[model samples]
Target: MTRTLVVVGHGMTGHRLAERLRALDTSGAWRIVVLAEEAHPAYDRIRLSSYLTGGSRQDLALAGRDFTEDPRVDLRLGCAVVSGDRAERTVRTADGEQLPYDALVLATGSEPFVPPVPGRDLANCFVYRTFDDLDAIRGAARRGRPCVVVGGGLLGLEAAHALRLLGMRPHVVESASHLMPTQLDAGAARVLHRSATGLGLRLHCGTAVASIEAGPDGAVRAVVLGDATVLESDLVVFAAGIRPRDELAAALGLERGERGGVLVDENCRTADEHIWAVGECAAVQGRCYGLVAPGYGMAETVAGRLAGRSPRPFDGTDTSTSLKLLGVHVATFGIIHPRGGPAAEAVFAEGTTRYAKVFLEPESGRLLGGILAGETGSRTALGPFVGHRPPADLEQLLLP
Candidate 1:
């Protein structure tokens, strides 16, 4: 019997789920329909900031950009699934179209969080999320104009770098005591702050945005800090954080996490068997993953289940990240800071070239996790060592 599968959302995870299912389901027992809210099909959202530099919209495409050619696939771009009727096994679109499905998968992903502040709705104010948002910012940015980016996390720093690439001076405002406080410890954050400052980025750590002041024409003019200091700005970008898009899940009465995400089991299945959840929208064990790697893992898990194959249970993710942030090579994996415990620790720093730290089991010398900044050539050898014992000469192996 041929079954119908309706996938809600066409982001990277959604696209990945479709690809995985197609590759696994060689018997052709199921036909798939992908509903995407965005006008364009799925693209590499991780490189969204790259569009501001030299990368084009087409360069960020996931796969070959054409899934419609597949006989078993129905790709519907700019079509949003407005609601679900579980008993009827049907979903309604925003355009008042109804589609029936034997099974439904929710991969609605997440939305950018904008902090509520006065003048946040000003003309030149923006949130860094989509290509459209970047285009809007690019249109408003002028050479020598000053831009204020709220939040010093990865996205905020990316936005600052994008603005700098657009020929604008950027000021980063972070409420936390240090930049990337959640990702990096205080010591690493200090080093990052120095690197960012050397790159001509103005950093305002431990500062709160009291309000955004606009000009007479209602465009951004300045950002007022908690200490009454004003940062002159022609543009203001909010990259505070992200919140999962779980409105459909909420409306369907699905269990949710305390922090607002659709609750799912190890199989990525919701309370109802016919419906499954994955990606940022699905919160497994009461925790939602905001990173792409975990979301990709969830997508793969759900795809395996849909393929009717005995796949391994979804058991969380490593939460490790390796990327270049504003020309700085930064990599953090496992437990960078462990509570008082018996773990072998090694620290190596070579001036401005690199700062590397690794944690290992005391007796077995098994690698747990570590942090690498500046020169991360050691990441190649150290990354695979996670969860396994390194070579006996591990200390010499990490030399820059």
Candidate 2:
């Protein structure tokens, strides 16, 4: 008898779980039902900024024809699981259809965190997350006018770049001392700061938006800074951070992490044996990883376990990140910051255009973490050496 596997959420990780499960369960032991809240199937959210610069929705799609056409998979788009009865082993959709499952997986991902400043709900203020959000931003964006972006992290920088692509002047406001405060160190952020400024983007670090002031039409006219500075703006975008989407957990009486996410064990299994969770919605061992790589790893692990394979326990995942912001290459792997006492570090820089640093164990030459900014050509070569001893000639690896 084939078991029914109902997966709530069809983001990248959810799609990954379906793909992996189908491949592993070749015996047709399980039929998959994926319920997605969005009208469209899974798309590359990471490249969402490209849509403002001529990339189409099809270009960002992660699912292929083969996956969509699979007979054993029921892909229900625009169907949200409103609630569930854990005791009855079923979930009810928005349309009042109940789905029974032998096992259920929550891959609901995350939602963008919008700060609670006054006038944040104004017509022109938006949050950068979904394709629909981008569409709204593009419609509100005016060429040659100033746009303010809250947060200087990865998503914030991406939004600023999209505004620039639309011929709008972008000013990024960050409460931290520098950009990408969580990912890059001070020296690397300085290099990134130079690169962003070179691209004509304005930077306002160490300050927060006190409030958004509205125009006569009730849309955003300007933003007041914490230090009593006001920045005139045509629009505002909030990309501060993300919080896990674990709303369904509350109704099901499922435990959650302190910071918000479905609490799950190493195998991505919840307290109830019939339920499991992956991706941003899941807090594996009480930690939520917002990156796609770790989410993918968790998906694979759950798929393998469901397929009757003994998968390794997921203690943690590679937190490495590599991306291009305004044409500047940046990458961070392993531990970017040293904990406790100061650790030995190797540094290299080429004026203000490039910067690279690597942390190593004090006694042994084992690599701990690293950061590269500007031309990050060595990320691919240097990635494998993390947590292991790098080659003797470390200088060559840091060269731009």
Query: Number of the top candidate by TM-score?
Result: 2
Q: Note the clash tally of each candidate.
A: 0, 0
**Candidate 1, clashing residue pairs?**
none
Candidate 1 lDDT tens digits, 1-400: 9999999999999999999999999999989999999998899988888898778999998857356689899999899988878888899999999899998999999998888888889999898888898888888999998899999999999989888888899999999999887677665676677788888899998988999998888889899999899999999999888899999986677889899888889888988999988898888878888888888888888888888888887866467788888667888887665546757877867665566778887877778888777755556677787889777766566654
Give the runs in model 2 whose Cα sits over 4 Å from its true position: 337-342
lDDT of 1 at 237: 92
In terms of lDDT, model 1 sits at 0.85
The digit string of per-residue lDDT tens for model 2 on 310-359 reads 98877564578888887788998877656666779988888778899998
Please give the TM-score that candidate 1 achieves against the real structure: 0.93
TM-score of 2: 0.96
Prediction RMSDs, each to the true structure: 2.2, 1.6
Q: What is the lDDT of residue 337 in candidate 1?
A: 54
Looking at candidate 1, the ten consecutive residues that score lowest on lDDT are: 391-400
